[model samples]
Target: MTSTTAPKPRLSIWMRIGAVLLGLFAALLLLLALFPWDALREPLNRYVSERTGRKFEITRRLDVDLGWRSAAVKLDGVEFANPSWAREPYLVRAERAAFDIRLWPLLSGRVVIPHLALTSPTLGLQMEEDGRRTWALGKNTSDEGTVPVIGLMEVDQGTLDFLAEHLGVDLHAGFSYDSSRGEMPLDFRIKGRYQRQPLMAQGRTGNVLQLNAAGQPPFPLEIDAAAGHTRLKAKGTVAELASLDGIDARFDLKGQNLGDLYGLLGIALPQTSPYALSGELRKRARLWEAAGLKGKLGLSDIGGDMKFDQSQKIPSLSGTLRSRVMDMDDLGPLIGLPPTERSAKAIEGVAPPPSITEVKRARRDSGRKVLPDATLDFERLRAMNADVKYTAERIRNVRELPLDKGSVQIKLKDGVLTLDPLNLGVASGTLAGAIRIDGAQNPAEIRAALEVRGMQLSRLIPKIETMRTSFGKLDGRINLSGHGNSVAGWLGNASGDVAALTGRGQFSNLLLEFMGLDGGEIIKFLLRGDRNVVLRCAAMAFDVDKGTMNSRSVVLDTEDTVFNVSGQASLSKETLDFVVRPQPKDKSILSLRTPLIIGGTFAAPQAGLEAGSLATRGAAALALGALNPLLALAATVETGPGVDADCQEVLAQAKRPASREAAAGAAKAKKQ
Candidate 1:
C-alpha cells in the first residue's frame, strides 16, 4: 500500500489544467496593469471621427481601468468638432472628462455609460431656420443613430451657447451641478433673446443620476423666465428629463397678445389684447395640454382647457372656453377691431407699480363707417386646424345692443373656418345661424345664414315709451354670400336677401303719423292722446345683388292707414333711396298726404318731403276747394282700400329660399 501511494497520487487532469490556467491568468493581469492605453489615443480618435463624421481628438493623456463588470475611461483635453456650417469650431470640448461604461454590452458593440463627469466643458448647439441642427451628428443633419444610455452625469462650470434662428432664440447659459442639493443638483441661468425679445431665465432640476432610473422618483423642476413684456413661471416634475416625458406642471403666463406666442409655443391663436393666464400644463408624447385655465384677457375673465396635438400633419388645436360674464369689447381683437379703453384695474385686479408704463396704441381713422374694415390674414388661418367651443352666460359692455348670452361652435380646417350654431340671445329672442369662411380661396369667400325669431318689440325699443305698450314679435332672416378679406369688403360685394315681418300687432298712431309725415294725423294725435292702431300685418323684403338692395315687396297694413315703401339701397356706396306713401283710412281738413323721400348716405341719412309731389297735392287741394270744400277732401283720400296681406304667406316669403332648403335637409337628415 505504501509503495502504491508513493507511486503518486498522480495529479488529476483537472489539477494540471488549473495550474496552467492560473499561470496564464497571472501573466495576463500583469500585462494589462502595465499596458499603455495612451497608445490607442490616435487609433480611437480616428475610429470615432470616422463613425461620427466629425473630428475627434485627445490633446493630452487617456487612461482606462478595466474590471470584470465595467471599465472606467478618463480623457484629458478632448474635443469633438462641429459641422462645417456651425459657427463654433467644436461641438463639445472638455479639459478633463471621465466615464464608467458597462462591460456586457461592449460584447455586442454597444455603449452603456453608467456615469459621466466633465470638468470645464463647453458645448455649442445651433439650429438653422430651415430646421438643420448641429446636434444631429453622424450625417450632420441626420437623426439616424443610436444614443448611448447614460445613467448619471456631473458637470463643473459648464458653458453652453445655443442658437435657433427659426425660433428667434440666441442664448448663452451657464450650467453646474451641486451634490449638496441632494435630489436637485443641476442649475442653470440664461440671458439672451427669444422671439426677438429680451429674455432672462433661471432654472433648477433634479439630479442627473435619476434621469434614466427605472421607477424613478419625479425629477423636480422650477423655472422663471421673462421675455420682453411676457413672463412665464413654472414649477413641476418630470418623469424623464431626457425626452421631456411625463410632465406635470403648474404654470403662469402673461403677455401682450396671445398670438405673439406662436413663435414660442408653435400654437396658432388669434390676436388678442394683453392677457394673464395660469393653468396646469401636461404632456403625453405628441400632445400638449393646458388645463384648468383661469385668467384675464384684457377686461374679460376667461376660463378654458386647450390642447395642441403635434401628431397631425398640420397640427390641431381644440378647446372649450367658458365665461360667466364676458365683456364684448374684449372680443374686438379676434375680429380685427380696435380694443376699447378700459381701466387697467379691471384686468390686473390691482394697480401696477409706477415703473410700469402703459402701452400706447395709434388711433385709426373711423370715417364714421359702421362696418369694420380691418384686413384678415389668411396666412394665419392656413397655418393650423382647430375645433373649439365657446359659451358666455352673460355679456357686458353691449350698451344698447340688446345682447344677453352667446355661444358658438368654431371649426377651422385647411384654411377654411366655419362657425355653426352661432347663437346670440337678443332681446328675449335668439339670433341663430351659421357662417363659413373659405380662406383658401383667393380673396376669400364668406357665406352666412342667420334667423331671428320672437324678438319682442317692447324689449327691442326699450328707450321708446310708445313701444313699451306694443305687443309685437319680429321675425327675420338674412342669407348672404360674398368674397372679401374684410367685413366691410364682404358686405360691399354681398349678394343676399334680407326680410323682416310682424303679424297681429299694434302700432302707435302718433309714431306712424310722424314716420309717414302726415301733418294732419300728427296734429290730431297731439290734440288727443296717442292711440294704438290695429296692425293687420307688416312685411318688408329685399333682394340684394352686387351690393345693391332692391325692395321686392314692402307693405304695412293697419286699421288707420296703409303704407307702401319702394326703393333701392346700395351697400357698396352706403347710400339709401326710399319713398314711403301713406293712404289714410279717413279724411281730415288739414291732411297733407304727400310722399316722403329718404335718400342719403348711411353715415348721414336725410329725410324730407317729395317737394314736387307735395306741390302737386297742394295745387289739387286748392283747386278742389275752389269747386267745393267737402270735395277738396278727395286729394287727402277717404277710402282705405288697402287689403290685408296673407299673414302666413308674407312670413313664408320673407324666409330665404336657401335657408328653407337647408332647414329641410337638416330635418330630413335628423329623421333618417
Candidate 2:
C-alpha cells in the first residue's frame, strides 16, 4: 500500500496502547458472559467463611452473569452463623441475593456495587448485657481496605428478630419495600413485649435505600404504636440508618392514664386520669427535646416543654410546665385519693361506673379504709432523676379545698423528691412551704414545713360575714415529719407543732356571750337578735406527739371576757376533747356553774356544760352571799405589752392567780 503505506504514518504509543486495551476489554466481556463461575462455589464459600469468621455457606448455587450494562453475582441459599454468644444458630439467611457491579469501577481495578438486592432475607439481632450484639459482622474489614460505595440496597420480604432478655424485649418484625411506583415505600410491622407489656408497632418510611448512603439525610418516616392502653404516633425525618441522630417531627400520645407508661418504661409514676398530648419533638445525638406541648391533664388544659439527656447511665428530665386554672380535683389521681370529679358527682347523687383497671380498683379499695395503705411504686423512683417546675393562674372546682393561684417546683434525685418551695395564693392569703420525700427507705420518709399568713378568716368560711366579724388577718404554721407508705400513715405517725394567732377582730355578741357563760348578756341578746363583740386577741398552739395534738395554750380575749381552753386531739383516733372556762373581769352569781366542754370525734363534735355544773349552781345559790366576792378564786386574766406570747406563758399567767384561790368550789367559778 503506497509501497509501504508511507510507513503506516508511524502509530503513536498512546493510540497503540488504547487499541490493545479495547481489544482486551472486548475479550473480557465475552469471557464474563461464558465463564463457569458456578464451578467456584466451594472455593468462594470457604473464602467467605474465612473472611466473616462465621460458617458461611451457599447451599444451593452461585452464578455470575454479564448484563448489557453491568456484571451481576447471584448467590442462592446463603446463610451465616451467628456469633458464638448468641443463642440463634444463624445471624442471617437469604433465599437469594444478587449484586450488580459497576463496569467502570471494575475497569479501573476497583469494586463498586450499583445495587444489592436481597430476597427473603432473615436476620437475628440480639443485644446482651455486656453491650455485645449478634448483629455485628465478624472480622471482615481490613484497616487498609478502601470503603466500598453501594448506591442502592433493597430487600423484599425481609424478616428480623431482636431480643434483649435483661430489658424484657423480644420483637419480631417483617419488612417490605417497593420503588416501582415512583416513590420508594418501605413498611414494617412488629409484635413483642416491652417492659412486660404487650407491644405492637406498624409504620412506613420513604426511600430507605437513599437514606443508607453516607452524607444523606433520612427520609420521612411515620410510626404508630401501642403498649397496653397507651397509644403513640409520630411523623418525622431522621438522619443515619443506625443511630437515630437528626430527628424532627410532630408527636401525639394518648392513653387512659399516664401512669400506665411506667409499665413500658422503668419509671415511677402516680395514678393519673385519662390524658392526651401533642407536641413538637426534635433530637440530636443523645439529646432529645419536646416543645410547644399541649395536652389535657384530666379535665384541665396544660402546656409545657421537656428535655432529656441520655449522656449518663441514668437519664434525666428537666422541664417547665404551665396550666390555666387547674382544678385541685385533678390532683386527686396523683395521690391515690378518690377522684375529685367522681366525688363531686357522688355528692350530687350520680353513681359512677365500676372500676375496670387494677389501679382504679386499688384506689377504690383505699377509699373505703380510714387510712391510706396503697404501697408506692418505688421502682419507678429509682429509674431516673428529674427537675420540673409548674405554675397555674388559678385552681378551682373543688369544694373541700379551694385555691387561687399556685406555683410548685419539683426535684428528684437518688430516690428522693423535694418540693422546696410550694407557694400558693389561697384563702386570700399566702401559703408557702417545703416538702421532702425519701423513697430510698423501705418505708418512705417525709418532712414538711408550711405557713399561712395574712389569711382573712372570713374568706375561708362563707358563713362568717366579713361585715359582722372583721375576722382580722390570721397567721399560722405547721411542721411535721414522718415515715410511711401512704398519706394516712404519714399523718398517723407525724410529730410536729401547730400554732395560730389573730391580733384583733369582732364576733357575734350573742355567740361569744354564750360561749363565755355570760347568761344575762346572751339571753338579752337572744331577745334582741344579737350584737357585735370586740375581740382583742386570740391564740392557739399545739404540740403534736405520737399522732396526738395536746393543747399548749388556747386563749380568746374579748373586751367583756377572757377565755382559757385546754384539750387533746388525737389524730390517729380522730377524737377531740376540750374544756373552756370563761373568766370575766366582773363577777356574776349565775356564771360559776358553767364550763363549755367539747368532746367526741371530729366527724361529730359535741358541746355542752360540764357534768354537775348546773347542779353546782343550785347548791352555790345558798352560799352565793358568802362567796360572792371570794369567787376571785375562779378568775384569771393575762394581758401583756408584747402582742404575741407563747402558750405556756398565757397558761402560766392564768394558773398563777388561780393558785392563790386554794382550790375553791364551783360557787367561785361564775362571772357576771
Which candidate has the highest TM-score of all?
1
Return the clash pairs for model 1, or none: none
Question: What are the lDDT figures for the candidates, one per model?
Answer: 0.77, 0.70
Candidate 1, 271-368: lDDT as tens digits? 77677899999997778899999998777778999998888899999999998888866776677655555623344533321111222222353344
Residue 641 in model 2: lDDT: 18
lDDT value, candidate 1, whole model = 0.77
Model 2 whole-model lDDT (C-alpha atoms) = 0.70
Clashes of 2: 6
lDDT of 2 at 105: 68
Residues 1-672 of candidate 2 have per-residue lDDT tens digits of 355434445568779999999999999988977888888999988986786677888889989887766788899888978877777677778999888887876565455676777788888888877666665544522222333556566776788888999888888889887766234387889899877678999988763454235566566778899886778899988775555667898999877666777777544455766667899999877888989999876666689998887888988888998998686766766676545443223321123323323344556443234444556678777778889898998787746454788899988899888886789887789889877778898688777778888887777665667337777787876776767777767767676666777777887776666666666565566687777877777777776675677776689877767787898888777778999877665444335436789998765678988878656664555465466845532432122112323444664433321311211211121110
